[model samples]
Target: MDAKQTNGGRRHFLKTGAAAGLALKVGVTAAEPRASTPALPMPEYEKLDALALASAIREGRLTALEALEAAIARAEARSQINAVALRHFDLARENAQRLSRMGRAERAAWAQTAPLAGVPFALKDLGVAMKGTVTTQGCAFFKDAVADHDSTLVQRYRAAGLNIFAKTTTPEFGQTATTESRLFGLTRNPWNLAYSAGGSSGGAAAAVAAGIVPAAHASDGGGSIRIPSSHCGLFGLKPSRGLVPMGPKMLEGWLGLSAQNVISRSVRDSALLLQLTQGPEAGSRTGPQPGALIDAITRPPRRLRIALMEQNPFGAPVHPECLDAVRAAARLCESLGHVVEMAAPKLAIGEMFGSMGIATAAGMLASVRMREKETGRTAREDEFEPLNWRSLQLARGYSAEQAFTARTVFDQAARTVDLFLGEYDLILSPVTAAPAPLLGAMSLDQPYESFVKVAMTASPFTAIFNMTGHPAMSVPLHWNGAGMPIGAQFAAPFGAEATLLALAAQLEQAAPWKDRRPVL
Candidate 1:
């Protein structure tokens, strides 16, 4: 956590800016409008995705400060969604001003090196860390926790020249499928505030959907990125395990059931993010070499054999609207020249779920113990929700043999899915059993059994790939009758993100969801 080690060479770039005066003028609150400056024309700001915004800044059509202010204005306007966990508006403004003040030649050079320079961005308040910033992880136990160093991924984000302005909410330890917690309150969906913004990356999804930022850093332990994207009508990709770094603190999350990526409004932004951050840091256990992910965005994938799965693997009845969404996506893929067939991989649902539960409980228990060690106090039961507290109890009872048995089960599931994918290019299914549910339906405070049932039904398909360590994405392709967005989940073989990105780009072009916006 040495300052020099954490900041590296970027300390001068971040700290030695002439923008301190401008930062003082902008103030610290993200929700405050800049009355001293001319009102920013927002339609243009809302229309451009992250890549387009970065391009404008590079071409001098827009100043980085203007982009940042526009994002701040939107964040203020959409305050009801409660997505902003902690704001660093002063720092963001200073960063923007510094970028705006760069010499033309210097700016041109920066553009070449930092493809996402001057773009405002947010990070989920879980997993990743930012120096001098508090990442509560949506839990009261760590409400005062401040990161001493930037996480490896945060360092990459800064190197890419993304302006890190704010952190988004998540369920405590990202333990639930909805973005509601005792600490951060409810993170409502932009499409409909009555519904939940699917979590634990829900706040990230809501921020992007609300146009606060075009894309936000999100991670998926078990469908966190994709569930929110599906609910919010955005594109989210969970890269294959080890394709995105999770290290410096820990090499893997939840025994490699997790991966870090972005929830983006555009396919290219996600592709570019993966291109920028996909690599091993020191002590990485797996080094999956980066592929041509960004280049794949421009190229249409060849005719693919897609497996269509309609039934929920967990035996929960798939909602009619969800069934309709996947069916429509299958038809669309068929029209796109991909052969579609009714197919699914056989899975031991009970074992897979049981193993996942064990892993999650073990992780939760370890995190609590680590926090206790750091704070010199044991965690109170009141600090955690009922389910997480129950997880701690469950973890205390689990033996090492049981943990290893869980890993065996996960390995078996991965092998089973790998065999299934040997005959197909991708598997297409519903991201969830239903569309975004009403807030409180998946609350962590609910009875453990009820929460488990809801969580299992809410996200059945995405976790399969999580267990298998295969690349998967939730592409926003359909809207239900109630006007909620339903995502069609597409998963590729392990380390086949190129295929997923190419197919996502093709779908984005075929059924453009760019212009779609929630009426806030």
Candidate 2:
């Protein structure tokens, strides 16, 4: 149908029946008051971060079921964004009801152990798995692929007392920068519905930005975590490779390039989540020990040298607003008593991306083949998106020698970044070369070449740190004349997540972003 006609229908659906059937199917009675008696208004609930919400629940001011219902109400209200891929609202309510059954003394004792107990959380629909849930990964071929077991990360999330209610949208296999796929349509930005919510964690960012939840599970293989955080005005941290578990199903993702974490509104939520979930599982390779991230967030980092890079390494033209955001962040750092200089590590940008592409293609092909074996059906080209089909073809063409060469390049780049960090404590740059693009600008249905061009131009900085295995983050510090959020990127040495979190907390204190919520 025509664009205007389609949007008009969407608006009508959202206004009338978008969430009606889903609420009934999930057995959600959002209008009914809970027994705990006084529930906070939606606005007040949205104002509290996950930590504060947990504190309130612990103190008996609110019940876990009440918080879950509030989140459900918001999610239903913001259904027009199409951010959610799968809803487990009934299961989440069961979990929350279990918590509500506890006595006040029992609840307080449990809260002391499970710091974020009673907070609602969503998982990105790509990497990682939750038992009995279908992790479609935004691919038609995997649309019915139900996970029989939870990934190690999901176990940790449950242990931390987070209520997993839904799965967020993602691009097909998370191959693109924006979250749009045939399986789940466009996940739009909460700030502006026409604009894109950056991906492959777009839905996670959208949920948080829309006030459905204060934080959600997100993974970064390329720029997935930080890109959406930038677009949606949230704080996202991609911990160093091997710090967070990615195992039991797959040992590492994209040859150690992907790290799982959360896209959160507050620094402490991200820090505490990291502290709770990080560490190697049995039989997994471990990276450098991440020091106490909670402690790091509480205390400001010592003033140190920070490198500010404005130019895109790939020679792409960065938007003026993005450049302005980075400059403003640099000035903010200086005001906070840290030294900021204009410098970037020298590296073969072309080779780095080339290696990443090879790894990405191979990973996609492997996943497809594995699924094909399990299902006893070969995947057809028609079943895949254009870019993903092209990726499988490229993966078939590459030789073993080429894959080895890509690994070598990854190693060399990691060494180069490690040495660069010896001279500077952090690298500050734009999370994306531009602010979030409008929807359809980076759709995977387009020609593979054109899609790659747009994706690279939009997110030129984040994948490099992913390749180098360094911890990086996107801090929402600036907004353009149009009021779109622009995030400043920060990268530290491998295993220095503590340092990154500390500085992020400092920035949060110096220029707070907690009060800025999208008017959904």
* Model 1 Cα lDDT, one tens digit per residue, 1-520: 3435533422332334322222112112212122222353334666577877787677565678878988888887778999999899999999999999886568879988898899999999988889998888788999888889999999999999999999998999998889999988999998889999999899999999988998999999889999999999999999998988887788888888888999988898899999999988998767567898889888799999999988999776998998998999999999999999999999998888889889988977887788789899999999988788888898999999988998898889889989999999999999999778899999998887777777877768988888888899999888877778899999998889999999998988888787666767
Residue 164 displacement (Å), model 1? 0.3
- In model 1, where is the ten-residue run with the lowest total lDDT? 23-32
| Model 1 segments more than 4 A misplaced | 1-41
lDDT of each: 0.85, 0.86
**With candidate 1 superimposed using the best TM-score fit, by how many Å does residue 418's alpha carbon deviate from the native?**
1.1
Q: What does candidate 2's lDDT look like per residue over 10-123, in tens digits?
A: 345333433222210112111212223133233456656788778766755567887898888878878999889999999999999999878778987887778888989999
Residue 491 lDDT, candidate 2, scale 0-100: 96
Which pairs clash in model 1?
none
RMSD each, Å: 8.1, 9.6
Sliding window of 10 residues with minimal summed lDDT for model 2: 23-32
